[model samples]
Target: MDIANSALRLAERRGAAGKAPPLESSKAQVELANARIEARTADAALEAARRELGLLWGNAQPDFESVDGKLDALPQRGSLDELSAALGDAPLMQGGRLAVALGRALLEVEKSTRYPDITLSAGVARDNEAGRNMAQLGVSIPLPLPTKRKTPIANWRRA
Candidate 1:
């Protein structure tokens, strides 16, 4: 926009001095108009995007004026192999990998339920009447019901 404005001003000055053709000033004016329209369009888009971003954070209206950054800089190009390797670390790919890991862990837990857990207890009790301490030991092993184990494993396998 600035460039276009400068060009228009220079063209006008040259025309006034009779050093430039009238056509040059007309072209510069058109260019300036185009630049103004483009700047307005870009501003509208930026504002809309800002409002959208604000909505994500539960804000009805955005408060900020402008964002800071350079849009002209291009990202460095990479080889196909490097890009392929980087793809594995991308968010979507990471999510997929995590989902697979979660499923495997869930399946392992379900498989573990096929075997019953063992519980062991040992305690010493003071018998006041006998004036002696007595030790007791106990072990418990829960029976795994086939019905309890089969359903979840089947469900996971189906998934």
Candidate 2:
């Protein structure tokens, strides 16, 4: 479809550029041919998709002449409150909510298990001849602690 439209645009531009008469006719013919080819390709693709859909439904071969349905018809949508009420008592919706809560709980567990970037080192040195011994211990921890804040803006009001 895009290719055919581009060819048509090119033909129009060539004609507007005051090209030779013969070249204008040739471009028009090419554009027409491209359009025809695109239409045939689109039809074949749609038919193939229909056949594939039939096969997916356990049909060996699709013998339907033409699909009968309105592609533009939109389903009626309920109000938000009604939809919410419907979902509140639905088993599937409840399960989905539970699953989401479980997932979040698991995520929190995973997050809590993460150790902060820190390092600890200990070293001991001894000089037997001098009868001197030194021990050193060091610890390093990251600063500027991470924090998360969430606020709902819907309740905010100007004074």
**Candidate number with greatest lDDT:** 1
- Residue range 46-157, candidate 2, lDDT tens digits: 8898889899878968888677778899889999999988888899988999997976676666555455668899999998998999898999986745546332221122
TM-score of each: 0.47, 0.31
Indicate the residue-level lDDT of 69 in model 2. 79
Query: In model 1, what is the error at residue 87, expressed in angstroms?
Result: 1.6
CA lDDT of each prediction against the hidden true structure: 0.91, 0.74
- For candidate 2, list the clashing residue pairs, or say none: none
lDDT of 2 at 67: 72
Name the candidate that leads on TM-score: 1
User: Which digits, one per residue and each the tens of the lDDT, describe model 1 over residues 31-126?
Assistant: 999999999999999999999988988998989886777799888989999999999999999999999999899889988877888999999999
